[model samples]
Target: MIRKNYNSLLITHILDGNFTYVKNGKHTTAHKGDTVILDCYNPHEYYTENGFESIWIHVSGSNSYELFEEIEKSNGTLIKCKDIHYVEKLLFRIYDSIKGDTPPSELRISVDIYKLFAELLNFQTTKSLGENNYEDTVQQIKEYISDHLSENLTVNELAMAAHMSASHFSRIFKQQTGFSPYDYVLIFRLNRAKFLLKNTDLSVSTVAYKTGFNSESNFIYFFTENVGISPGKFRKLKF
Candidate 1:
């Protein structure tokens, strides 16, 4: 396959042989049962010395590029899938949703996309850790950020906590976590709010304050923007 100036995110689950190609001047190959994620924007082509079969889905959305860029930064275009059968099921579900009797609902489709990406992110390479062992360093950074989500945690503060310069901290952080410091804080807050909403009877306003949002409206706005539902509605999902 060859395409230039393509604009969708492609996730391919290989079935036979290997996918060999040159992407951005880097030649790589994906063996059978491995998943390959390629950003379509760059010029590339793929073929195998032997025949190959695969299931692929092209995705385009608001955050596709940002997520793909993170994956690329971590390791080129391919990542391992822990359970190839699970991936096959997911791909089949996506296919059935698109072609089955009832058209797939927007919520259902979005959920499928989320699950697929989550699987991909789980298996990406931690290349930013570089030559030395930084497991403890990264763990410290996570703990500090998790412990102080209410405070305005910036890259500088996080770097200080990890005893590294901001530039180096950010590079490693992004590789290890798939999120910038700010994004990680935002996600942490949102997830905390989700936990509160699902497990407690606190009003949305109180939850907002507890999660570091300045106002209930702002919290609701951010929650709805990322979660595709209101806090009230999401709470009902769990209950």
Candidate 2:
């Protein structure tokens, strides 16, 4: 049994066996390939029936506390890693770098730690999106969007393609792609208009229709607002 309260974060990846972790008096079981993240300031405890093999690291200073809080809010204290081998490799790299004869600077170690946290956050996001096939699903949706670039798309239509509710699809889409579906559609249409303007002899009005805008005026307004120039002026530029 181990318990403590401090201003650091502890992340442990379980490689073998099982253990029970307690946070705020709630007991959770962690098995192989599971990871336990603890904000040391939150009194917690963990113990194994027999014995378990694990790799862990303690991080503090800088934005470590803020990062931990964000991750905890998204994934809670106990997380199931998508790839335990990758997590182990990262932890081992940090360990070896520090234990070697020529130890790296603190910045190098901090960067690796940040990368580890990123991977954890990614896993959490992917898990929330769906099972392991979520990436394939999102890719398929993107392809559908591309293939229908000349049509006015709606959240209901896109959600039907994704087999999810509009609100759920919108939430996960932004989490995965950093843009809402409407914003993504708008950006895609803008890029297609730019391509037609730059690479083809299509007129501005033709480009507007081909890219799904309702009128030449709307397309010009949007293009000028986002690209900082009118489409005609944009096409006239040589470099």
Clashes of each: 0, 0
**Model 2, 72: alpha-carbon shift in Å?**
0.8
TM-score of each: 0.51, 0.52
lDDT of each: 0.76, 0.79
lDDT tens digits by residue: candidate 2, 1-239: 55677778888988899776767644455778888888887778665544799888888876877777788777666677778788888899898888889957787888889888988777856454345356556656877887787788998999899999999989878875678999988977876676578767998999999889989999999999998999999999874
lDDT of 1 by residue, 9-35 (tens): 888888777756657534355778888
lDDT of 2 at 155: 85
What alpha-carbon RMSD in Å does predicted model 1 have with respect to the real structure?
Answer: 17.6
> CA shift at 73, candidate 1, in angstroms?
1.8
Please report how far candidate 1 places residue 163 from its true position, in Å.
27
Please list the Cα RMSD from the true structure of every candidate, rounded to 1 decimal place.
17.6, 18.9
